[model samples]
Target chain A: MDFVNLGRTGLKVSRICLGCMSYGDPNRGMHSWTLDEAASRPFIQRALELGINFFDTANMYSLGSSEEIVGRAIRDFTKRDEIVIATKVFFPLNPNDPNSGGLSRKAILREIDASLKRLGTDYVDLYQIHRLDPNTPIEETLEALHDVVKAGKARYLGASSMHAWQFTRRSIWRTCMAGRGLSACSRITT
Target chain B: MLPLCAAEGVGVIPWSPLARGRLARPWQSATTTRTENDQFGKGLYGATEEADRRIVDRVSEIAQSRGVPMAQVALAWMLSKRPITAPIIGATKPQHLDDAVKALDVKLTAEEIEKLEEFYVPHAIAGFK
Candidate 1:
């Protein structure tokens, strides 16, 4: 698969990112971006045929069930290292469980471990903050993310669906901004 | 422009880069007229007969002169813009992709671009943020 740097990070992903919002379940009402497990194989097979190696998924997407499916599908089917998997953290898995979500230091640390277990991977290529946490200090989020990178749990970090605008609409400038979040996903695009 | 985008390293994937099957014949939507915002809106064809006819004619002329699909002319214009990393083309069916790929190699000159732009210049396009 052809690789391109994702944003400013040294980490590179396929130019064609397969979006997996279509891969996990049927209740397409709450977070409609998903595909059921049964339909995931051919979808993945086709993507591989097209040289698509990067995928995107988030915890908020089907509340983490999507992550499990992506992790299991890839591990059980394709060669692990050839394809890159990314999933996100943020939205609550259980709305009633307040401590379960957000970007607080505690939330990020705990969620990263949970995401690691769910993803069934020792280290993520790009660990992203699914969304910025207003409740937690940016320093804490950055440090937590930095710590993960230092510990080797996550290889690098990236962000998505961000509202933060880059001044140069033309240049692919790579800056280590202080305020931002990261998310991960594994694509099975049709 | 492609050089500019390349210089800036801005990756661009133009959505509806070909105006949703409007560039090709056996034109998919048959209502002839659709809500401007509906996926198959005739806004591309022209708001009025005179206007739409002009749009089609401009595309048709360039398409014929270039000896390629009109959609190719459009994609070529974009690829001409170069630094475009990719185009997020929507494919309702397989032919949609087949049709879009046609424009990959058609490079439009500066004059042709200006002419095509003029054809639809009068349309009161709406809703941009």
Candidate 2:
């Protein structure tokens, strides 16, 4: 497998990242066609054998079971430091709970811990927002993510499945913040 | 997304380069797990199925002449784009994985690439919903 640095970061990842959306208990999640642990293990093992060290999953995938399966599979087959694991947040985990979704400070802080616990890891290589949350202020989301990086919970921040203009707005905001001489992931009380 | 990502040096990883099996199979009988499960995909590609078939037909023609699977030719066409870092292929079987890896070797000419793209009309963005 070919290796490439993710974004501008020094994190080297395999060109082929094994997406774990399909690995989890089919009975426990939104997707009816997901694979159980028994069926998912071989695919994870095969991907590792093929020299793919990068794996991506999300907290909401299979209702958190995907993270569990992926974590167990990686631990069983490879060393912790040898692979790059990416998981996403921002989706609602509980429909009854108002605090369960979006990129708000409360949600990001809560979800990262929940994800790390499920993944059986102290830190994730990358933590991403699963989608854009229009309800939450972008600054709050960024600051919360910055806190995650500062606390050593995640090595990098990423966003997924958003419009180009949305991404551009976030990117521009980040640049402006940087230009103001703010440190990476500094605490913002907003 | 491709050009903007290229300009920013952000690696572009494309999902569903085969349009969730739409490009791999004949348009009339097209149906996959995604088409069945994902209403978003149905709305995205299903409406353009007739127009997109022109591109898929070209891909099928190339694949038949070169003795490669249709999926490989389609994947090769995606790989031919410079800004793409990797095409994230969803493989259920080992053979699916093998075919995807082989797509790296199926080279297409400039003319073939142009012919394949000639019929593609823009549609509403999918995948971000």
Candidate 3:
């Protein structure tokens, strides 16, 4: 597989990133057609054999069973340093809890720890906001993400699926913050 | 979007580059296991299947002439576009991955690309929501 630099980061990821959205238990509430852990292992192993070192998943995928399956497969097949793990946050893990979702500082702090534990890793290479959280202030979200980086839970930050203007504003805010010698968002995408 | 990504040096990773197997075998939507199981793909491509069929037919023609799988042709077309760093392929079978890896070699001519694109009609974007 071909390797390319992921944006401006020092990380070199395989061009063909294995998306783990399909790797979860079907019994989970997310979707009816997901592959179970046993069914998912061969696909992950094949991807590794094909030289794919990048994998993407989300905390809410199959209620976080996707992360668990991916983590177990990666640990069994490859070394920790040999791969780049990317997972997303910003969605409600528990619908009953009002504070369980969004880009709020409290949610970010709570979710990252849960994701890290599920992935069986000390840190993730890229921690992304799964969607735009209109309820939370952008600055507050960035500050929380910066704290994630500072606390060594994640190395970089990413955003996904927002209006162009909102994304531009977020990108500009991050750049300005970085210029002023503060933590900033690393990428705006999707 | 391609131009902006290029100027910013951002790598574009195209998910569902095969359109969830629609481009590979457009007619297979009626019976394909993936299409049956993929509610997202059904809503996204199945709604516009008629419009996209013409594009799929052209891809099939090109693949026939080149002696390659339709998935390879579709993937090669995406790779030919500007600012695409990678096309994330959903390979359920080992052969699917093999087809994707070989797509890097199936370069389409200008005429072939124009033929494949001429019949495409835009519809609502899916899979993001």
**Which candidate wins on lDDT?**
3
For A26-133, candidate 3 gives per-residue lDDT tens digits of 877556677889888998898888888878888998899999999999899999878888889988979999999899999999999999999999999878887878
lDDT of 2 by residue, A1-190 (tens): 6677765567787666667877889887677767789988888888888878878888998899999999998889999889888888988989999999888999999999999999999999878877879898888888888888889999877666666666666667657766211111100111
Stretches of candidate 1 exceeding 4 Å from the true structure: A7-9, A165-190, B1-129
Report the CA-based lDDT of candidate 3 relative to the real structure: 0.76
Tens-digit lDDT track for model 2 on B19-70? 7777776655755565678555566576777788888888888888888888
* Interface DockQ of candidate 3: 0.36
lDDT digits (tens) for residues B1-129 of candidate 3 = 445556555455656778777778746645655566777667766678777888889988999999899999998898787666667676666677778777877889999999989987766645444
Distance (Å) between predicted and true CA of B114, model 3?
2.1
Clashing pairs in model 3, backbone N/Cα/C closer than 3 A: A161-A190
Worst-scoring 10-residue span by lDDT in model 2 chain B: B1-10
For candidate 3, what is the TM-score?
Answer: 0.89
lDDT for each of the candidates?
A: 0.55, 0.75, 0.76
Candidate 3 local Cα displacement, residue A19, angstroms: 1.1
**Model 3, position A5: C-alpha lDDT score:** 74
Tens-digit per-residue lDDT, A1-190, candidate 1: 3466643345565544555544566463244334567656566566656666665666666666667767787787677687777666666677787887877777777888887787788866666655556677666767776777777777756543333232221022223443222322111011
